[model samples]
Target: MLYLSQFIKMLLIVVIMLQWINPAQAADLTVSLSDNQGNPLPNIVVTLTSPATIIEEAEFSPQHPAIMDQIDRQFVPHILVVPKGSYVAFPNSDSIQHHVYSFSKAKPFELKLYSGRPPQPLEFGQAGEVAMGCNIHDWMLGYVYVVDTPYYGKTNARGQLTLTVPPDDYQLILWSPLLDSKDSAVQYSVDVAADSKIDLSLKHALLPAFEGFEQSDEFDDY
Candidate 1:
């Protein structure tokens, strides 16, 4: 009887120890973004950064370079998300030539007159939004969001994004090409505990709509 009692005590101690060793499980984070009119906003980039997370730096020459193809006189995939210190290839798929350039401080360079892929892809060394435009095609606009953290995603047509992340604290940043300025960008401090879902709305209206490439005298200066 005493031996059985000792065995039962040992089992209880083991269970308690196991509970302490394994704590809570990580969770998935979902973010929903919409414009002021309560309509879903697409192509909005949602970025999360945390001090506890470690982001491996991408070398100047990345094995898989992000491709931004130029087609139908417009930048395909209008928004591109790239890791910091990575390379991006601007491939001109259309028969017409393309001259891509960006004034963004993250990485500013001019790709002068290219028919196919450039000799070397452009490198993004910093973490910020890079606005791209073709010197020849003024209406051809695109954006590249360089993120230092791994927990980042762009919202879809439904303005929703989900990321599996460790349960911790983070700083969330929401950016859109249509934003009037950086001052209007949405930023929030949030804590990710168990599976979390957050709904966000933009403060300002998006830029005026210019769906397709229209002949405008303003484009002459570009």
Candidate 2:
């Protein structure tokens, strides 16, 4: 009887340990955004922030530095997303010199005119949108979306984004530079469980486009 009691206690401890070690189930989230006319809206940044309890318990680390290349006097990736505290590399691929600067309160820094990669990537320690522009090119614009949570995705040409994340309640944010600069992003509360899909329709039309850029009707974040 004494040996049986000890064995049961050991089994109970192992069960408790297993429960503590296991993580919650995960799910996939797909988001689609479009204009009132049903036209796809690309370059939109979407972020999902889980509850504080889930954030503290979530096991995730920022990946390698992201790259924002300067090509043809424009930012290659007009919209860039990175986790908080992640580094971003600005490589000037064009022959002409390019000076990158941002006035954003989240991270404000300037890379003096250069033709190649900088010594080190710039670190984004805060979670907010950073609007950067080239001093030489008035039309050159880009956006850096720094998010604290790991669950985020940028919309593709089809205005669709898909990402996998642990099932939980989250705060969802959608940002687009084309939206009136005054109100560039929208936020909502969502509960994600099994594979889910969300369609977002903008309440206001996007701002006017820059005529001199590649597409006369196209606009990028400033």
Estimate, for each residue in 1-222, the C-alpha lDDT of model 2 and write its tens digit.
999999999999998888788766678889898875688888778888866522332222334568888877778788888777778888788766778899999999988657654547778888788999878677788888887887878888999999898788888887766776534555677788888998887777788757367442223433
Ten contiguous residues with the weakest lDDT in model 1: 212-221
Query: Model 1: residues >4 Å from true position, as ranges?
Result: 1-25, 57-61, 180-184, 214-222
Model 1 C-alpha lDDT per residue in residues 1-222, reported as the tens digit of each score: 999999999999998898788765678899998887889988778888888766676643545678888777777778888778788877777776778889999889888656754557778888888988988877778888888888888888899999888788888988766775752454688899889899988777788757745333334444
**Alpha carbon lDDT of residue 59, candidate 2?**
26
For each predicted model, how many residue pairs clash, with residues at least 3 apart or on different chains?
Answer: 0, 0
Best by TM-score: 1
lDDT of 2 at 83: 76
Per-model CA lDDT versus the true structure: 0.79, 0.77
- Give me the candidate number with maximum lDDT: 1
Off by over 4 Å in 2: 1-19, 53-63, 181-185, 215-222
